[model samples]
Target: MTFATFIKNTTQFLFKAGFIFWLILAILELLMPGFVIYYINMQLWLIVVCCLAVARAFLCKEISPPKADAPMAQK
Candidate 1:
């Protein structure tokens, strides 16, 4: 796969993962106090990394179009 596609996919995956992590953490905090507190900092860093990756993906150039030499369907 192309670099742009790889970056885009990676960012998407990370975003989903981060979202799920926070959701779980929220549930845990509601059930128990001080538990999962250590993960707060780590989760924040994950958010930051995901944000940076998304930014990079947006800045990446669009994929090139197919070449004319490729085969075409016959009528």
Candidate 2:
């Protein structure tokens, strides 16, 4: 595969994996009780995963249009 395709696939994979991890953590939090410290830790982890996912998506090895070029897509 080309470098661009590889980067895209890797980024997508990481994002999906992070989302799934966060979902499982959220479910565990809901099912369990009286674990305030664990809940807070999970929440922090979820935030980190979400941030990493977004960063991976945005910083993938692909070129994006600049602001001037991007405006045309909205029309």
Candidate 3:
């Protein structure tokens, strides 16, 4: 794959990972009660947001037409 494609895929992976991370963070926040949890929760949220934003940027690229992959078609 080309560099751009690699980056796009990485971003997509990161975005999906962020969803899982967010869920884990929510669960941890619910299960535990402490000042440290609050700090960790805030940091995780920021990282997740950044991941989503970077993935969104990759998805909005105007330089190339959308790729037609079998994985997408399966959905």
The TM-score leader among the candidates is: 1
lDDT of 1 by residue, 6-59 (tens): 877777777677667777877787799778776566567566867856675675
Candidate 1 achieves a global lDDT of 0.71
Clash totals in order: 0, 0, 0
What is the C-alpha lDDT profile of model 2 across 1-75, one tens digit per residue? 999778778777877887787677677666776544454676677677787777786767467566564445554
Q: Give the TM-score of candidate 2.
A: 0.51
- In angstroms, the error of model 2 at 16 is 1.2
User: How well does candidate 2 score on lDDT at residue 57?
Assistant: 65
What TM-score, over all chains together, does every model reach? 0.56, 0.51, 0.54
How are the candidates ranked when ordered by TM-score, highest leading?
Answer: 1, 3, 2
* Candidate 1: worst-modelled 10 consecutive residues by lDDT: 52-61
Q: Write the per-residue lDDT of candidate 3 for residues 1-75, one digit (tens) a residue.
A: 998778777777777777777777777777775624746656767677786777668675778776776565554
lDDT (CA) for every model shown? 0.71, 0.71, 0.71
What's the lDDT for residue 33 in model 2?
64
- The window of 10 residues in a row where model 2 has the poorest summed lDDT is 66-75
